[model samples]
Target chain A: MFDRETITNDRDPLRAQFQGMKGKLCASPELKAALITGTPLHTPAVGKRVHIRRFSKAIAVYAMCALLLLGTAIALPSLLKGMDPTSASSSTGDHDCIPPAVAMSSPSQLYERLLSEPNVVYREVGTIYFQDGSVKTSHVTEMTRRGDLFTTLNYGDGEPEHVRYYDVGGDKPCVYYNRNDLWFTSELRGDNATWAHWCKAYMAVNWLEDEHYEKTADGYKFTEEFIAEQIEEFKCEDAEGTLTFQDGVYTLRVVRHKEQFREEPCESVFEIQISFGNAPEIVLPEATICTHEYEVEVIPSDHPCRYGDETRYTCKICNDWYNEWSPTVPHNIVDGICTGCKLSEEEIGNLPDDDPDNEDHSDIIYGPYVEMSISRPSMQEFLEFYTVFQRKNTAPIVVTDLGDQKNSITQYHFYGGIINKNTFPDDYDYDYSSGEIRVPIQFWYSFYYNCDDAYFGTYDYGIVAENYTLDNDAVIDLDNIRLERVSTGMETFSAKHELSAKGKKEGEIRYYEIYSGENRLMKFAICAVASTEDSYYDSICQQVVDGLVKLG
Target chain B: MKDPQDDRAQIVENYADMVWRIALSRTRREEAAEEVVQEVFLSLFQKERTFNEEEHLKAWLIRTTLICCKHYLTASFRNATISLDEVGDLPAMSEGQSTVYEALLSLPAKYRIPLQLYYIEEMDSDACAKAMGLRPGTFRVRLNRGRNLLRELLKGEGIDV
Candidate 1:
């Protein structure tokens, strides 16, 4: 391998050799022949511009003539008459005064004369589609002409995208995009355009006339009189000129007007400001006649828009065509139906009554909570908060017990009560007339948790632990609880459930106490919704936990 | 008002060698190279666009020679680069030229082009980089790899490193 060091070392020497080689090649006779005859030729110097084979005889004859001319001075004047004007001319002053006239070939006159008679192909036009799904047909009324690269696109019921390749010569070909209001270069070279113009003009002028125009009802339907009349009413303003020189060819064309006609509205032409060499003039050629028929078929036939389930009010006319649950209105469709609802509870063994003074209520801090609170501190307050919490957090909040994954906390929902605007339980704190309750802060470190998919829904819940209430007015702190963002767009505090439980479940209560053990762990995950509106409640709940919950 | 003599002299001095080399490189036919070299220079003389320097002169010669080669080999030229690679591997005499120069003759265009610009043309990394449209750093890497591959044949023939 030629590594960097070797390559760098060789660079100077190699360049020196290259220079040497160039000199040798330049001096080599083979190279000289290659330069001149493009092949090695064994011959003496021949006259410059003399073809290799034309040498021997031609030079011999020329030398003999020169010798003869030197011998005869009297005949020399007549022999050299056309040869050297320099020696015979009396004065050099006459040469400086008059310049020879240059002959100009007028292709434009040839074009005009060629176009004076109707081009046979003009009777037969070809149709092409425009951007807006309307079609226009163009006819070659004259020889395609050397300069015009005009093509038409139908714009709606009129002209929309108008393009003309003008000044189509030179290295950079110029094209005019009228509708876009810009003129720029086309990628093709000018010579290519000239050759193409030659071919098209030849075809347009020479192709046998197909009276196909008369055969079609719409063909050539707008006669010269109608086009002239339309041109009279049209506006010609904001015209621009374009010029180009390329590939031994030069062209200049000016655009005078772009207008729609009053009577035959779709018939429009670029009123061209024409210039061949010196003079500039105007010509109105009917190029594009925009049609309305093609626009209606632009959209696919089976599209929902065609079936009348459109966003616009116009689609409502076809409302009877579909059901209220139609996917056309995305909001009405949902993943699964809410089939059943209920409340149940299982308790840890009852707590013995203790003195309020030594109870240490300092451990619980309830909220930055929102929603209705009936803080009457009745026996019912503890029952309702416990019930609602369980209904909301069905997914057990996992907590780390030991360092191992196996030793994790899981909640078993034995029983809890749920009450809402529609269903309110008796013996609940405030009747349906008074709404949901609030609890304050708590946070902790915990292991990750996953809810059983069968039990998780758009709304699901979990319970931490409960407290006995002195009355409905007693405030509870929620400082030790752990919950994760299950799904967003949850109507957070909207539902209130009040439960009255006369429960004794031996093992169930023990499990609740085990979950509430001093080492109960907590973790959090952010739940995001697709739409911005849906993320609000989830953001608030996450913030509330952060502000109020703390772990030691 | 230009004299034909001056134009012919200018074309010969400027483009004759470049046109010959491009045609020879492209067609691999000496006769074709001869034909193309003459035609290309003649055409340059006839064409109106004026060339002022070596770079413009070279570009015109290369472009014209390429067009002629494309016309001559229009059939097999479609995959001519592959043929070029096959030819680039031939042996060379100890005179600092390798058959790889011939093999370079065989080298497919993809390989042959970079090789020529690097070695034969004496174009440094940056110039080769511009010609190949590759970044200089990339051209350096490609040149190293291509040289190493060409070096394989030399190693087998007992050529000293």
Candidate 2:
């Protein structure tokens, strides 16, 4: 009777026979030649041939005339206009001295003219005073065209605090942070809408119909008032503005009032100046554009061709392909040559009245047999090989320092009958009640394979604490760290440290440090603390220490 | 750095035996097994694939071999009448062991392939499940059912297994 043990444990003679067959098949001379020459014994059927006979003489002449016409159509415009005068003049002085096309009479007229113009430059300054005595000021220099807009705004000093660019008619505008090489896109409304409105208002004389108009010595002067009813649409309580146009320049002054709460009144004043012609060029720092390109190369079969060898094909990106091989009928071999093909063996056993349909067929035996060792482990063996000691609690405990510039504080968690938070006297305050470890630490139960073919199950956890200082007088010994430096052959010093405490519940901690020169780059610690003298905890801890992988 | 061509050759050499074993377990014919192994290796060689470890490579080969075996079986020109007797002879074994081998081969391809990977290849149930694209629990159920079927077949043949 075959039990589960026998089925799982018994060595199958078939496996050995098959393995021997594989060795013989791979060592075949035909396969070796095919692999080296990169050629198939049977040529693949060619796809339907696309035959294009020679073009007729009349058709060829017609195609030539069409090509000539296309060339003439492309060249006609450039030939008639010659070289552009503006492009030919390379001097910046000559370009800047170009006169304005016409004088703009009104704000609306100026805005209409500027919309058609390529570049328009202007500056706007706005200051707001709140009831709480808080003040915010924004000074901006900007340039704009039909679909393009660029602006630099300063909140405090003359230096730009924020720089933004918007291709107005297209996608989202990308704002660039100069301090950090950070760029992000946001929606077209909110602050961006306000900037767009300011730029349009600078060129136009009567963006909003004026409440009062007066003729000044230099140019036309106009004033407009937005009451509480109309202010909501403009995102303000009430607003009053006056605009003056003089000699291709427009000056605007606006005051806005808002009451955020019942008693908190806020007021803002804006001064804007717009000048026609000669807008400075907008230059942007280079940035990488994220894209992907797929490159494919076909790889032929690596092995030589056998009696039945499939066509090998490959695409270099993801491992996906179509494979086909010729099928061959099994044939009997006598003296290393196929007897089925020769018909010699059948002729020797000839019976005059033998019917081919009723004849019995026997299996063909192939040559050059090799010994195969097939000893499969039983179920019990598998269990023993895969079993290992693993900790129940895989949650990570993190120690952090929170103190003044020089003060150092270390945190620890000790669990023995109940959870206890231990706080020592130090200059820094420690809070562990949150139960959430803020540092980048991850923990999970995982299986580990040992050298003895046994699995040592472990509570896998990793710590990522960067540039942490260990005070000399701290409870944990700082100088007694047993460090083993690993040469990664890079500019960083990678090391592992093992430290253990013998008193009370035996605790073991494994610390890994990565340093660049004298500066400590990163420090990670994996600790296993137990209250009792349990060997399982120690074994699991040891396994975890051995399985530590340094991430660069 | 290893040249791409050399790396491909090494991959083919190292995993050819395993791929053939898997293919043979499914098709049960030497020619079909050879065809499936060639198809699987050629498919792997043609693509740009990155394996994380040896386990991943073996798993990919096993999975691809099974897929190729399926494709070969479904081909219009496939000779379904090709019996085990026509292919080759097994190494001499006792009557009971021989019966067990026949019973195992008689099981459906889905159940037999997993059993072969688990018992013959010595892969863990998890690895077998991954290669066969089955959940661990589902694979265990299928394996148990397959063993029961084999046991019944052996009993019918008047040999307890």
Candidate 3:
């Protein structure tokens, strides 16, 4: 048999080969950047723009010769005409004096038309979310292009806020970030110059009418959703734009989402603001994500029976808000029926509670220590529960010596009298008045009838353990919490109990502990379910122990 | 709330490679493996949940990686073409190691996974079985059978384990 040492020894091939797996598979920083920032990495070389030819080569070649003959005749006349009045002929750079009002894609003949366009500044106001639609480490990116100089400031939380300079013109924009590594260049290449995403977005959008519209008194209002497929300069799996014309003004909003690691589209979209050329000396904002200094209000559900509360968190700064669903309030149970939910614990266990008189009494069957039942519980006598549980109950009634696991030829009753090491006498003649029960902290109870299956069934319980008087119904911490109904909400306290009690035993042992701040006593009424076949009895015993009101 | 970047770094450090390996094994494509790892981590970081044990976290990554692998294979929009070179990582040739590695890859995953997990990953047989969704005894039998086949394959290659 091959062992760990045999397989993993330094001399071995398996271990040696795998030792370099990390090196070969070492994750790229771009991958980490993509994962962290949610950027797409699929930068296919901006594919050549396909042009559909209108005419075939044969016809075009024949027509070209005729046009050239006519053009040469006109040129001779024009040259002669110009020579007679020749002073000096000159031309200027083809750049237009004005920059485009909208920026996404610039004209392809940039060399001809770019020089005249004035320096442009792009500032993204408000919040900038990452690919995961999270504002964590959010920063603003400001780009300004003047002549051949394009400066970008990407400053904020997740990464070090730094100002980078790029010499832009012609090719890709290359940036050198760190002072130490002077030669290292950034992916901030000429292909992905600061304005490229905007340019790509502008060029790629094929605006389609949105199916959804808001009905208005005049007629209807609709927005156009622009869709962009794979474009090389952009890394996103897709980019979408919403263009809406309202009144006399037009607005465009673009959103991009992708994880470079997967090179796939994701649901988390980042909404960025793009405005062209109004070069204001750009400055950073006070908050990358909203400060959310505004107060939040949580309104409880009107249907408390089923739905929990709906809460709204609003930001005073941005008026940006989100909502959340809180869990339903604990079911309101009265006499085994909830006034709030109108369902009893038995009904929740699944059946309607038609019998008004048949109120559940878990304390009766599972001993007085347990205050309530979470799952439906049925128990009659201790011996009956012990038999099926495979545990011999070593209650004081059975074992003379305390803390003993197996009590021979004997049986036990469930008795929890913590604070006193000694167990109550076999015939203590106890009533359901004053009982003190705290588990495993000071006392241990091992009651067994038989074996294996029983040990597996014990589940731990935690509680506040404050002095609380038990009533016919359950409530806790007594006078501190004056609610009439049982509360399942447990506070964190380092107390736990797993009743590793075993087998079929059904018997009543009652003494309801009373501590209403000052040790007062009250007896709880008993409710017993009938026991039948051994399996039937064991199943009920399991529920009794199982139900022990799962505290947390 | 916890700092998101710190949380991301911690989760990536803890499970990135484990996820990468599982994804690589299931998808059998380098590109698909990277995609699966990214998707799994994205889903993990996006959702809000807590695990009491690192074991539970690992189990979740395994399950999620398998699901991601399935999605990658079955996605209607996927256009990626498979390349033989991208299928798996190659080990350095030393002694009969490369031969052994090739044989291991040739075996069916059901048998291969048990051996790899137990021997290569140093996971116990019980954990290997649980991960493979098989009973402990079944996993042990497969391991033994897989070992025997590997030896036979190696012998045929003029080498002995």
Candidate 4:
């Protein structure tokens, strides 16, 4: 079983640590009083109370409602007349809201009545059945006033193929391209205008000439046919249409038996059903309007004309440019340089032979190479020496030496501070070649809770680098070094060792060494009393070593 | 007679630890956890609400702490960049305990909150589901997944738990 006990027990220590924090977290007395009283501690002049105080102004709303009710009753009939579905205009009271008892005599009268209704929506579904028995379905939705807000969703094989929204109320009508996710506006009024113009031009018909009218149980019906010459002009063998009106809606359908054009047998059908009602509210996205305005001017090329080059012209308005290529002589190269618009060598010699003594000699060298030796270490070598002392400390475990600010070495003094208040012997030397820095420090650890008798010792604490090349001269013993993987935003290994120095006892001095890479090694050593129990100093030393980061 | 201010204080005193732990587990930042704790308690102070039982109060605190932690993480003005050194000083824990805490902190938020509520708060799967506004089945699945991920992460760090 997975150990859930570990996670449950992990918070025990933290809970104990936070046990008494509630006393420190109590709200102030003033805050507690404000909370109990439900009053704002810092009240603003413009506040919620001010808004509540203004509700007394609502008494006039009832009087306004009574006036509106009286006005509505007086204008109710004209309002009903204006909203009548069958009439084109309120002034024309010829058509009733209900279908007339007398049948409409012609298809023209039906079409005129259907087109005249305001706020009407229609959906037309047409299926084209090919001679080969394949079928294709198409759908179109039309609305009069709010047609701009209508969306037509077309389905193919029981799945949505595309959606199109029309906005006709704007200055120009537009079709929203669902696939492109954009609206495309047209200069024409709308689809209805285009269809009306096409019908008038190609399929001109006189509904009265057909003289076919019937009154069905539902409503009236009318049928009309185009002339033979008009049918021929429309590329169809026959063209006919039917119109019906019932329940405040009109249905118009047209069928054209197309003559075989391009050796394909097909018939085209169009149907429109119109109903009058208030259009549904449609939310439209803010659309980007297309605008075009640019001032065009010819700008000549700023560069001088070269041989075999072309002249270029740019528009100052939009920086659009074009180049006109023309034939020209190529430039000649003399002494690995272009000689275009340059004087000959004889002309150059005639201009400059006046001052022989004043010639520039800065580029000429005066002496051969000389060698000198200085004992100061390079910046990289100096930082390596400095990092050894920094790695020995428990705090500021990570030190970044950015090197000298301005080509001079930055010297840092260690160990001779007021805290320690001790002077080192004159013979105490730092081994810079091996990257070693040794400082004498006192360290102590207690094992058995006897503060007075705790182990106190002094020893030389230092850091050393052991460079191991690929040739195995100085290999670390894997068995002897206790490795702990540490991450300082970069992975490295820390080696812990308990060893006896020249004067300290074995297992009394602790050493922590971090291996940066194959070449550089940083070590921290402290003298302490080591027992079988885990030493807190070891963890602290490990933390310091883990913080080591190379900033070179 | 007991006043509402005393009731609010009693609630804060009782549930502050659980709320702080949940916030710390979710945010993985001590300062952010402290801020979430303050926000949760301040909301409880401002709103006059009644709970059916002590369990309901605990659930409300956990839920509010999770929300506050999420808000702190996603607030536009919150600093997005925090260095590893800034997160170095965790509340003192044993080395092994620190390893477990790191493994828990490394988990994704969805799994971390449910795991902390279930294991640390000793809330059952149903209670945890109610606190997180999740179905019992979904909470169980997340708990199991979170446990497995934590086990793998601890194993990678050479910790058995």
**Superior candidate under DockQ, 1 versus 2:** 1
Clashes of each: 61, 12, 46, 3
Minimal lDDT window, size 10, model 2 chain A? A401-410
Query: lDDT tens string, model 3, A486-506?
Result: 112111111111222222223
Comparing 1 with 4 on TM-score, the higher-scoring candidate is 4
Model 2 bad stretches (over 4 Å): A1-552, B1-9, B77-79, B90-99, B156-159
lDDT of 1 by residue, A408-481 (tens): 11111112222122221111222223223222111111111111111111112233223422232322223333
Looking at candidate 2 chain B, the ten consecutive residues that score lowest on lDDT are B74-83
lDDT of 4 by residue, A37-139 (tens): 4444443122111211111111111111111222222322222122223322222222112222222211122112223432443332222221123333332
Better of 1 and 2 by TM-score: 2
TM-score winner between candidates 2 and 4: 2
Docking class of 3: incorrect
**How many Å off is the CA of A510 in candidate 2?**
52
On TM-score, the leading prediction is 3
TM-scores vs. true structure, each candidate: 0.25, 0.27, 0.28, 0.26
Give the Cα lDDT of each candidate.
0.29, 0.35, 0.34, 0.35
Q: What is the lDDT of candidate 4?
A: 0.35
Candidate 4 Cα outliers beyond 4 Å, as residue runs: A1-552, B82-88
- The better-scoring model by lDDT among 3 and 4 is 4
